[model samples]
Target: MPRYLISFEKGAMDHIPEEDFPEVGKTSHAVIQEAKDAGVFLFGGGLRYDDGDVEHAVVGTDGVVTDGPYPESKELIGGVMIVDVPTREAALEWAAKIAVACRCAQDIRKFMYDPDLIE
Candidate 1:
C-alpha cells in the first residue's frame, strides 16, 4: 500500500474565529473518523504551537546536536495525517475533504519508501 501525507500550514486556520473552533474540530474529527472506518487512516495529529516546546535542533555529521530549525524555516506544520490508500487520486480526495472540513488548504504528499526500513 502507498502512504500519503495530508498536511496544512501552521496558522492556516487562524482566521477562523475562536468561537467556531469547536465546530471546526468536530467537523475535522468526523472526517478523520470516516477515514479510519474506511481503513485508510494510519495516524494523524496537530502539532504543539507553543514557542517554548517548539524548539528546533540540528544533528551535525560529527554527532553533535545544535539548536535552531536548521535553515531557519518560518513555515511549520500545523497538522498532518497519514493515509494508506491505493492511489494518488484517492489521497487527493482525502486531502480535499480535510481542507473543506477544516476550512483550510491541504497538501498531499507521498512518503518516500526506504527498503531497509521495511526489511
Candidate 2:
C-alpha cells in the first residue's frame, strides 16, 4: 500500500461565498467520513489562519529560523488528506470525490516508500 497526499491550495475556494462555507464543510466532512469508514484515511485537516494571516516559519541550513514561509512561495496548502490505498486509481477516485465536496481542485502525489515507515 502507498500513502497519497491530496491537497488544495489556499485561496482555491475564494470564489465561494462565505455563507456557503457551512455547506462546504458539511460535504467535505462527509467525504472524510466515507474514507474513514473504508479504512483508507490516515489523517486530514484544514490549515488555520490567524486574522487572515498565515502563521509559519522557515528554517535555514545554518539552523536559523525565519518567520513566515519561503519568500518564493506563490501558493500555500490550505487543506490536506492522507490516504493509504493500494493503487493510484483508487487515490484519484478519492481525490475526485474530495474535489466535488470542497468545490476546489485537488493535487495528488504518491509518497515515497520507506521500509522503516511501513507497519
Top of the candidates by TM-score: 2
In model 2, which runs have C-alpha deviations exceeding 4 angstroms?
51-54
What's the distance in Å from true for residue 49, model 2? 1.7
Residue-level lDDT of model 2, residues 37-117, one tens digit each, is 999999999988656764777788999988777797557888999999999999999999999999999999999999999
Report the C-alpha displacement of residue 36, candidate 2, in angstroms.
0.3
**Candidate 2, pairs of clashing residues:** none
Worst 10 residues of 2 by lDDT: 49-58
Report lDDT (CA) for all predictions: 0.90, 0.94
TM-score of each: 0.86, 0.93
RMSD of each: 2.1, 1.6
Clashing residue pairs in candidate 1 are: none
* Candidate 1 residue-wise lDDT at 90: 97
> Counting only residues 3 or more apart in sequence or on different chains, how many pairs clash (N, Cα, C under 3 Å) in candidate 1?
0
